[model samples]
Target chain A: SQTIHQWPATLVQPVGSPLSLECTVEGTSNPNLYWYRQAAGRGLQLLFYSVGIGQISSEVPQNLSASRPQDRQFILSSKKLLLSDSGFYLCAWGGPDYGYTFGSGTRLTVV
Target chain B: QKEVEQDPGPLSVPEGAIVSLNCTYSNSAFQYFMWYRQYSRKGPELLMYTYSSGNKEDGRFTAQVDKSSKYISLFIRDSQPSDSATYLCAMSVYAGGTSYGKLTFGQGTILTVHP
Candidate 1:
């Protein structure tokens, strides 16, 4: 079985502070990884997706960026946080057969 | 028009009643359909998935896809309080290139099952 781990279930950051959220998947290799953000009332929006290591695609332009440093490790980072950056961030891994397996998610609040 | 549209229903239903959640899409290229359930402050879990059209049943949950209408549905029989959550509909294309495995999700519908 595969499992995804996301750290810092809840985070509060000061405005203009740096942000880093990490997600790692175990028991799978070369899986497609995705980053999504869900705002209040709005649907889950795709932020970034990676097909392989060092390959990332941005779905929406924003302050956040994603990186696939390792095959099973994905990281979402921002040099400076904005008030609008606050939302529920989700990490997911999937394949061609089974659908995506999402992590517990990181709730970010920029104050 | 939105690629995928779902009613954001804060629907309330009694226990043991049948629950129906639906989503409609404007994209006809979608070949893979899925339904996800999310609890409060939790990640969405893939509850059911169907390829193309027709009906697929697993235990108490039934997933229906009508490609002609570009609509998909999820039916929960004998609903319980635990089943109260937000349901999201997602779909993707079958092409092996960039579009493959990329899912576009609906806004999600909230359902509350009272005990």
Candidate 2:
């Protein structure tokens, strides 16, 4: 079985602060990874996706970025956070069946 | 219009009642369909997945896909309060090139089953 772990379950940062969220998948290799954000009462919005190491695709232009340093490790980062960056951030891995296994998510609050 | 459309309903139903959720898509190449259940303030969980056109049943939940009509549906039988959550419909073309597993999701419908 495969499991995903994301850290700092909840984060509170001031505007212009740096942000980093990590996601690692156990028991899977070369999987498709994705970063998504959900605003209150809104649907999940795709932010970035990576097919392999050093390959990232941005779905929307924003102040956020994503990277896959390792095959099973994905990281979402921001040099300077903005108020609009606050939301529920989710990291997901695409399985062999093409089903997505999502992490518990990181709630970012920029105050 | 959005590539996919779903009713954002805060639908309420009693226990043991049947629940139905639906989505429509404009992409004709979508061959994979999925339904995800999300608890409040939590990540979405995979509830059911279907390929092409057909109906697949898993215990109390059934997923139906109509490729011709570009529609998909999820039915929950014997609904429970635990089943109360938002249901999202996602679709994708096959895995290849830039389209591989790049899912486009619907707005999601909120379902609440009362005990």
Candidate 3:
């Protein structure tokens, strides 16, 4: 069975501080990975998606960026955080059945 | 219009009742449909998926897709309190092997099953 994991399940960062969130998947290779953010009580907003190692497509323009350093490792980073950057961050990977598997998510609070 | 549209419903129902959630889309390229469930403060979980059109059932859940109408639905029979969560509808094109799973989602509908 495949599983996805995300780090720093919760975090609070000061405004203008750097941000880094990590995600890793096990039991799968070269799967598509995605980063999504959900504001309070709102729907998900796709931020970025990676098709393969070192290849990323950003869905929305913002302060955040994503990288796929390995076949199953994805990272979301920001040089400086904004108040609007606070939200629930989710990492998802495509499945063999054309479905998606999401991680536990990280609750980021930017003050 | 958005590519996909779903009612942001706070639909409430009693336990054991049947629950129906729906979404409509304007895109004709969508050949794959899916439903996802998300608990409060949690990531969305894949519940059901259907391709092309017609009905697909798995246990207590059934998924329906109408390609001509560009609509899809998810039905939960014998709804339980554990089923209370937000349901999101997503669709994608069948772009052959590698491009098959890039999904576009609609705003989710909130479902609450009371005990």
Best by TM-score: 1
Residue A95 of model 1 has an lDDT of: 52
lDDT of 1 by residue, A1-111 (tens): 899999889999999999999999999888899999999766799899998999999998999999999999999999999999999999999954568889999999999
lDDT-sorted candidate list, best first:
1, 2, 3
Question: What are the C-alpha RMSDs, in order, of all predicted structures?
Answer: 1.2, 1.4, 1.4
- Model 1: lDDT of residue B56: 98
Docking class of 1: medium
Q: Please identify which of the two predictions, 2 or 3, would achieve the higher lDDT against the true structure.
A: 2
The best candidate by lDDT is 1
Candidate 1, superposed: residue stretches over 4 Å from native: B97-99
**Which one wins by TM-score: 1 or 2?**
1
lDDT of 2: 0.91
lDDT of each: 0.92, 0.91, 0.90
**What tens digits encode model 2's per-residue C-alpha lDDT throughout A2-107?**
9999887999999999999999999988888999999988888989999889999999999999999999999999999999999999999984256888999999
Instruction: For model 2 chain A, give the 10-residue run with minimal summed lDDT.
Output: A93-102
TM-score for the second chain in candidate 3?
0.95
Q: Each prediction's TM-score against the native?
A: 0.97, 0.96, 0.96
Quickly count the clashes in candidate 1: 0
For residues B1-103, what per-residue lDDT tens digits would candidate 2 score against the true structure? 9999999998999999999999999999888899999998788999999989999999999999999999999999999999999999998777666444778
